[model samples]
Target: MFEISPTEWTAILLSLRVAIIATLVATPFGIALAWLLARRNFWGKSILDAAVHLPLVLPPVVTGYLLLLTLGRRGMVGAWLAENLGIVFAFRWTGAALACGVMSFPLLVRPIRLSIEAIDRRLEQASSTLGAAPWQVFATVTLPLALPGILAGMVLGFAKAIGEFGATITFVSNIPGETQTISSAIYSLIQTPDGDSAAGRLVLISIVIAMGALIASEWFARRATQRLHGN
Candidate 1:
């Protein structure tokens, strides 16, 4: 898309990878936390709820820095990972994915939690009454009921992760074909001389991708809800 270089395409591709990885990594935890927050009664639940949403309200740079400190090459967890698994996150694409994941988590959880809350607990109870175990009931009843919400959350999180800038950059420096994403590429173009033409191209592509994701999610969610209601 860029006028002078392959940077724009590389950035777009890397950004897509980061967003996909982040969404996949966050899905299980998002569903679990959403179920817990919506269905469980426990002490300090509000605190957990607030913590889940902390990323949404906090400065992205702050979150990125925290991730760096905790997961950087020499940081505690990072040290262990390096020593044990020979894996490192600092300035890596994986680190960028982590940053995007953290930043997008709140958006992922909120809608799923609301969906979980909307589920009829009675259906789960009925499943249990029919000799289904807790896990079985959740799998068969609760999860099916919550599909639409979960889909919405996933779509939202993926979109946010795709657009993540501050956290991604702060945690992982923009390295072309490594950690450089569309947002970072766009930012860089905006800073360079006569870069507006290329920037405009990338922006149009970004808008199309975003609109596509939104439309797909809307259709899927509606169809899921309709099927569940019919059942």
Candidate 2:
């Protein structure tokens, strides 16, 4: 029962690929937004913050439908891209990644924002006084100080991406070997008469992956604290 089949392996691998891509692509944006929210006080800041966290509160299916309407083949942006750039997001693996990224973005930004907020600003001021350029100060002092939160956020985002189902299936249609991920696979499996064992296996794997991510986040958090305390 524990032996995995080819199709299951495919789903597992696809899930990993989608999650990793989503996390990596979203990280830089997450960091930038996190910093902006943490450090800046521009107009419409509250609105931007609310928008960032909108996915977390919105129903996943609603979010997916919004993506489809905006990025679907006939969508304004989607049509322009398809015409000018020959790119598409609807009913594709890339769509799956996009959906996952949107779904996980809030979780990705929160920890990083909190970490940046927790930073002692005097260090940044001191670095500036020491003739460090703004970019240099951020690179040397701000970024390093925020590393742990960034890592934690990445892991959390990856975890969310891997398990994403509603948005992924809605946007990408769960095509096997194309857009089917572990969550969608399990969803399909449990609906079939002879798929109980397979579904059970996938469930177990999901549990393992989630637990591992949580543990890793905790470790990163501890490391961050230790580093901050110079221990």
lDDT (tens digit, per residue) of candidate 2 on 1-231: 599999999999999999999999999999999999999999999999999999999989999988988899988888999899999998888899999999999999999999999889999999999999999999999999999999999999999999999888987898999999999999999999999999999999999999999999999999889888877
Evaluated at residue 35, the lDDT of candidate 2 is 100
Clashes of 2: 0
- Best candidate, TM-score-wise? 2
- Candidate 1: the clashing residue pairs are none
On lDDT, the candidate that comes out on top is 2
- Model 1, 1-231: lDDT tens digits are 336467777888888999999999999999999988988899999999999999999999999898888888878998899999999999899999999999999989988888887777777888999999989998888888788888888898999999999988998988888998999888988899997898888888889888988997788678667866776
Clash totals in order: 0, 0
TM-score of each: 0.94, 0.98
Alpha carbon deviation, residue 94, candidate 1 (Å): 0.5
List lDDT for all candidates, in order.
0.88, 0.94
